[model samples]
Target: MIKAVFIDFYGTVVYEDGEVIQKVSQEIFVSGKVNDKSEIGSYWWNEFQTAFNNAYGDSFKAQRILEYKSLEKTIKHFKSSADAVKLSNLMFRHWIEPPIFEESKQFFELCPVPIYVLSNIDRADVLQAIKYHGLKPAGVFTSEDAKSYKPRKELFEFALNNVGLSAGEVLHIGDSLSSDIKGASSVGINAIWVNRNNREIPSGVTAVKNLIEIFDTKYFLHE
Candidate 1:
């Protein structure tokens, strides 16, 4: 049986509003040749992951700084007349204040135990999202605190230790098959893949289409 529930913030709990980002990008990168302004937003996100993948603990950088740098590079490559710094600022601000998934909100409202956030994000950004969404988690922990990102065990251990629970006692739920499912399970915590995209689940991985599906599953209700 689960004693505590650990949720991931981005993609799992809320999504960065793509439409908003797309709209902002069009205003900034207004050009006759560019028919797909949304590519700017897409490139920004792709560069966001590229930045994270290139990040390191010994040479740590804040998420905001990385976002700005990555987006600036992306904008330059695309030859947009927009101010890369300004566009990056707008993108990061929109990211910090994201739309909370209604199903995630309802799940948080009804989860059986205290909920805490276990995310790969800057503390400030995650906290802001939590506050804006009124998530009111029992606690929030992140890579900025752990000095490492998930799929790495240190972050998970840090969260478990703070909550005073063994890995076996907590249930971790998130969207990534690699980071959320494998990461938690590797550390002995049971995990449910919040597969919002209906991706194919690998053998032995627990999955749900969304948080609402968790309430219907025996996994959440039973041991």
Candidate 2:
């Protein structure tokens, strides 16, 4: 029986920084240095992911710093004059104050088990956001706390150890397939994908459109 839930903070509980990222990408495209706005977005994400995957242990770096460096590299790669600091700051602001999903409030209010935040974001950013949105999870865990990011197992392990629960006794819910699903599965935790976009669900992966669906009779029941 599931004793608790581990939910992702950014995309699961609140909106991501996609809007600010799109704006930054558009700015780069308008500079005429990049051929397509989509390319800018793709390149930036690739750079950031690469950096994040390599960051761990003594080489660990904060998410905000990685974001800034990735943006800097993207600008240089496209020969764009966009101010990396300014663009990164814009992204950080959104990360700290992204709109909370309407359903999140409802789900939290009615959840049967204790919910803890398991996120790949910086500690301070997620903590500030939780406060800003008036969220009170049982606990909050971050990459910074573990000195490692998600999909790496270290962060998940760190969170599990602190929650004092066996992997089989916890369920993880998050939007990212690679990070949340894979990470939780690595540690033997069941995961439910919050596929808000109606994307194709892979074989053996249970998915829901939103948090409310988690309580469906087909999934799990309250108590």
- For each candidate, what TM-score against the reference? 0.84, 0.96
Highest TM-score model number: 2
How would you encode candidate 1's per-residue C-alpha lDDT over 1-223 as one tens digit per residue? 7789888888899984566667657754674235576676677778877777666678667777787787677667677666766666676676679887878778888887899998887898888888888777889999888877787787899999998999888889988888888888889988989887778889998888888888777656664
Each model's lDDT comes to: 0.79, 0.89
Alpha carbon lDDT at 134, candidate 2:
90
Q: Which candidate achieves the best lDDT against the true structure?
A: 2
Q: Cα lDDT for residue 113, model 1?
A: 86
Per-residue C-alpha lDDT of model 2 across residues 40-109, encoded as one tens digit per residue? 8889889998999899999999999999999999998988888888988998898788899989988988
TM value for model 2? 0.96
lDDT, candidate 1, at 220: 67
Query: Model 1's lDDT to the true fold?
Result: 0.79
Q: What is the RMSD of candidate 1?
A: 2.8
